[model samples]
Target: MINLFDTAKRILNPFFAKRHLLGDDNLFSINNILSKTAALAFIRAIDKGIKEKIEKLKDIDWTKDNTLPNFPKSFLDEYGLEDKPILLKKNIIEKNKLNHPDITEEEARRIIGNALYKPETILKANPNKPAYHNFISRTDDKHSDIVLLELSDEKENYEVINYHIINNPARDRKVNIHKKS
Candidate 1:
């Protein structure tokens, strides 16, 4: 479980770590440049990783009966130092079918499609719309906090299972809408 930023810093900081790289008059300026450079590098790495995950998911053979795949460890790993594997909530899928069988397939495809991009895409393209929703709650006994992405909305408040995050302050949240009986 490598911390992504920590790893990036370790790799990139040497450019700024040596005293020779810093200007005597303005150490603050040098530090700023180092931080910005490191941040950009980290973001690019993350974006690349996310794209890989999306491509992998796109390659799966989907069918009416086929179960959705779990989010790959490489992608979810961005969230934390530990492996934060994503679990697809089959029950929510079932409930979605029950609530609106007519639109279930379309919505499911929408989720898969919309999930292919970085969160920033939603932020820039559709600021008013939710970037994420709680499509499926993760159910790992070891990890209580699992991020469920809400991709799109269906009419009839079908998006209730979907929690908003894009423009909303709840962007950092991990939602578990399921109530244990």
Candidate 2:
């Protein structure tokens, strides 16, 4: 006996839409590429010159890359991300250190703020480091990744124990918050 639902699915299946045959890993790799694609587009939107640099990311096969698997199609495909981003929120976000899971968007300031703001200190401290100072052991001391450890019985899966670095751009990065006259 032929089921109507099954018949309809055969007619409307996404597999036939893009000539993409499905495998367990296939969807995941495509999702990874999709993420990169969206991020690259965002970068391109910010700068005309960046358009060319980000263009290389668009060439992904989608049927190949092997990174983020089982991504929500609705989010990645339709919206590219959350409508209300956790990272972009205006409120100060801190990083936790014990469990090591919660990575926030503000983390970039660790590098940018440090590079642009603390370049002198970095250079001064690492006089023998030469011009190409990438990172030092102090990076660990400066920033942390662990958010918090977990308990077996909590309603929430993980307890987020966010910790802000003492010298975070949020706190210490204030003297030059605005343009100087």
Candidate 3:
């Protein structure tokens, strides 16, 4: 078996040499090489952990808990709607779960609920579909969850048409800026 430590050293050696030669104080400081190397290793480890978690999620038997959860009364009250069953369909769950293997059913529910309660951004009367509104909420540093709600002709009924995770570099940059604050 290949030694990971040796492989990593081989890979990083060139990068370290280039950084040391370039001598860019802000971007790559030779004086901070040890710290930078440690930070990079930590980031890689976290990324690997996330990938393993996602793989575990993909293997889960979704059928074990196929029951659709109902939107809470508080969620209904926020939109000034009567307390009625507005459940997420199994097909939607299946589709989203397949699309975003990194997100669990409970995490998906929490993301949707959080978006409905306090969305970071809302695109009302979306150009593509005037009846559908997009609610975006940042889930983590790397992912943002979007919930699309379609208003019925009567304007009283709101149905969630779609929910999915998005990984946009620009969006992540904005999120990172906010996180810094």
Candidate 4:
């Protein structure tokens, strides 16, 4: 019920939180930086008295203040944030499970075998490959760049979920299909 997003916006924006430490003028993609920047805001909220804004947001007697800007009505009242404290740590954990089922034990793997992030790696020596031919592509090649195939983690710590990949316009993307035996 606490406008985590508004909280995020507050924490992430230097102009909002009035902290230049969050500033990174060198970064051209402010939008991209904001997403990553918001994560820190989430952390900051927990460490400080963001409870007031979070509380006021969560309290938001929607039955009364049901107008303008995010007008919290249905969800806020339903979650009972108007009546209780909501710790995101507990909520995010449980919510993740309800979101999806993990890949089955037998079907899953503990460790990722040899993986290829061809873009991050050294270009293969093959002279005539298409990767070497394009002028625009050569300037910013992701072929050898590491594409997080399998992330290493501790023990059985895994979760089920869904994801979608949005390709970088600068990088070439293609699906590899294998033929049936």
Candidate 3 C-alpha lDDT tens digits along 75-178:
34444456433434557667777777888767776666655544566655345566676667777777677777675565434666667677778455544543
1-181: candidate 4 lDDT, tens digit per residue: 2344544454345443344434345353334455645755754544343233323333323123111122122223432323222222233324433542452312111101101101112122223332221111121322211112111133122211111122344233322111110
Candidate 4, residue 7: CA error in Å? 2.3
Q: Which ten residues in a row have the lowest lDDT in candidate 3?
A: 65-74
| TM-score of predicted structure 2 | 0.17
Candidate 2, superposed: residue stretches over 4 Å from native = 1-104, 108-146, 166-181
Question: Where is model 1 more than 4 Å wrong at Cα?
Answer: 1-31, 35-39, 59-81, 100-181
Pairs with steric clashes in candidate 2? 95-163, 96-146, 97-146, 99-148, 100-146, 100-147
Provide the lowest-lDDT 10-residue window in model 1: 156-165
Question: For model 1, what is the error of residue 179's alpha carbon versus the real structure, in angstroms, after optimal superposition?
Answer: 20
Clashes (backbone N, CA, C under 3 Å), per candidate, total: 3, 6, 0, 9
Whole-model lDDT per candidate: 0.39, 0.29, 0.55, 0.27
Residue 42, candidate 4: Cα error in Å is 3.1
lDDT comparison, 3 vs 4, better candidate: 3
Q: Estimate each model's TM-score.
A: 0.35, 0.17, 0.43, 0.17
Residue-level lDDT tens digits of model 2 in 12-121:
33543456643336664333334545644543343343233223323323233211112123322332322221111112122232232443335533432232212222
Clashing pairs in 1: 132-150, 133-150, 134-163
lDDT of 1 by residue, 1-181 (tens): 3344554554444455554554536655344555656766766776576566555544433222223343434333443223322333455556656654654444444445344233222221223444343332222233211124433324212122321113222332322122110
Identify the candidate with maximal lDDT.
3
**lDDT accuracy of residue 16 in candidate 3:** 70
